[model samples]
Target: MSEEKGLLHGVWETVKTVVYALLIAGAFRTFLFQPFWIPSGSMKDTLLIGDFLFVNKMAYGYSYASCPSIRIPAVGIDISAEDFCGVFKGSDSRLFGSEPERGDVVVFRHPTRGDDFIKRMIGLPGDRIQMIDGVLQINGEAVIIEEDGFFIETYEQQGPLGNTPMCMNGSVGIGGDCMKERMYETLPNGVRHAILNARDDNPRPFTDNSGVYVVPEGEYFLMGDNRDNSGDSRVPATQRGVGFVPLEDIVGRADRIMFSSAGRSMFAFWTWRSDRFFKAIE
Candidate 1:
């Protein structure tokens, strides 16, 4: 009987350790760094599908983890904490006091369903943002674009073509269809980042039909670097795209890409793309 009791105690201790470890990990993920996966091509050529990234939770401030909350052991969930933290403690602006600036890559909850979304800030409160003739302009000033560098393209032929010879700019060396246009964009606050534009087609009509929207206070306008393809604030509010993200809806800021994979199938370790790993999100 004593032996059975000892064995039971050992099992309990092991379970306790596992629970404690999980709690610690959850706390760390909630407060410090959280991992997210890119499931869409909206930010393509910048962040690809199957890319795993780390978001810096501290970039803004604590939301709920820092406050007191009721924790259930077996359930592994926080019951309630917002009210205990303070009326507006976990609300929005905390003492840390950092506001989302233009050009800063941010992750916020979708206004429609509260799902997390990652995008770059383009327009701030009171800023007039309009896309004219395919070029992004802020307050009637055209955004500047500068060339950064170029890349190489590799190809393989199948069937009767067999293995085709790789070509460069003309027919065999660096500068053919591989040349990509890179530009530097400076935000209203002077924050600058490199942006890529690969589309050669003329700019489509501005999808934003709100008629010269003046961003209201406590809200922001966001757009993906793949401007031509992204569904952002520029779209009408009636649509499913992000119309405007409120200050409180922001979850955190994307700090860096931890790991990335090119093709689908998460289980295929051999298919992981190593080149994109640890790449900073510009």
Candidate 2:
């Protein structure tokens, strides 16, 4: 049989080299860079909890939230981004779009829990946005901050969902020493980041005083620079928060931090962090 036709032509050339390396890694993760895996700290100390980052999908272009969404909930495989481009989603129009300034650090697509959510942008379209006592005002002024002080850590569990981290030198007993109140802010076209503040003595914590918002036009306005724990857009999206998002659910712009892993298993490479590897993401 001619050695079974040379072992079926060497298993059909190793299945066409694993289907051309999975179609060139699925067209380079569907039109360039996607990865992203911070798992939450809500952009703390500028995106922590595990870090990993990629998400540049041409920095705000394609639509249907730039497709690519596989979500592996312990083998369940959720799959979203409207199941890979839901007829290019209700049309907030994208495909080559571009416009997402106010302090960058994006990564969207959760207009209704379609998953992915990194933040930062902070109001745009029509602007307005509020939050008095805890600072960030915009369109009515007040975005400066300054006092960059404490941020400390290790009050025990963190990452891999262990959570626990809101402290202004409060309760912390699990291995003690935690804090918060770091400032910096700036944003008024001048960027400047770092903003955390765990309870500046409440002063009326409705996300520290809100109710202004506005920002409609094409929709934008994100948050979570750890501002008192961040649920963002000051809360609404039917209450769970992350309200005014859609700019076709903007899925892009995260800039750097190739890997970080503070522990709970990112293969636990000695719990990495190595000065946050590629870092950048400011």
Candidate 3:
């Protein structure tokens, strides 16, 4: 009987250990930090393809965690891994009571697709946003454009030498390559960033050129840092130009780039772009 009791106690102890480990992991994943990858060039120059980033889940606040009280059983549903990693729920409170600000690089659910998209906040709620002659304007005030040096190409195509279509001299293409002079613009409230210009007479394709858009109270207007190349709020909603992202759909603000890898083949871990490791997101 003594031996049996001891064996039962040992089993209980092992179960407790496993339970404790799982609880700790759940807590960590719930409120500490999370990882995300840059899947598109929308934030190019700041974040590139294959870039792995770490987002501070607690930076805003705790939503899914049992802070004020223990979470009720069965109340928390097992959504997909993405929703499980996120802190908030429903289309409310955005995240942790925090709100997005202009110039913040944020990750939010696509208004149309429900997939994740990362972009810079260019217009806040109730702000008048429009593009005038390829320049961003807010509330009748022009965003200052300061020229940075010419953007230089950093990588080359790997295909056959002549396979890539060559553009006529000074022809701008869909890919935001073909760099020209750039300028840094400081918004009225000190939100300053860079904007690019191709130095050609051709204008952007958007026809709504001048209009006063009062960003709805719960929605935000986002734009890509690569202005000339990005398909963002500048494009009308009908064409799916990221019209207005609801605050509740935001996941978290992008904090920093963890690592970046290059090349079409990612099988080799060493092929990562080592220089961009641990780079802070502006």
For each of the candidates, the C-alpha root-mean-square deviation to the true structure, in angstroms, is 8.0, 13.8, 7.2
Predicted model with the maximum TM-score: 1
Question: Between candidates 2 and 3, which one is better according to TM-score?
Answer: 3
| Clash totals for all candidate models | 5, 1, 4
Residue 13 Cα positional deviation in candidate 2, in Å, after optimal superposition: 4.2
Please identify model 1 stretches exceeding 4 Å from their true place.
64-92, 147-182, 196-204, 207-211
Root mean square deviation (Cα) for candidate 3: 7.2
Q: By TM-score, highest first, what's the ranking?
A: 1, 3, 2
lDDT of 2 by residue, 1-282 (tens): 699999999999999999999999888888888898887787799888888878888977888878788878999989887887888788967878888888998988778777888888988999998988788899999988899788888887777888877788789799898888888988888989888888777543766777788898999889889877767777877677778988888888989998888887799799788898897888
lDDT of 3 by residue, 1-282 (tens): 699999999999999999999888766655665566676555656776678886565655544321212223468833443345344444355345676678888776665654567788888889989877767789888888777886544333322121121221354544535454556778777877665554345456452255666788877888887665566776655576778877765656787888787554445576678899988887
Q: Give the TM-score of candidate 2.
A: 0.40
The RMSD (Cα, Å) of candidate 2 is 13.8
Give the alpha carbon lDDT tens digit for every residue of 1-282 in model 1: 699999999999999999999999877776777767776645655676678897777787765423333545578865533434436533646546468778878877666654567888888888888765556678767677655664333332311223232222334333335333455666656776755444555254563223465688878999876554567788744586788777766667887888876545666678688998899887
lDDT over C-alpha atoms for residue 175 of model 2: 86
- Tell me which of candidates 1 and 2 scores higher on lDDT: 2
TM-score of each: 0.74, 0.40, 0.71
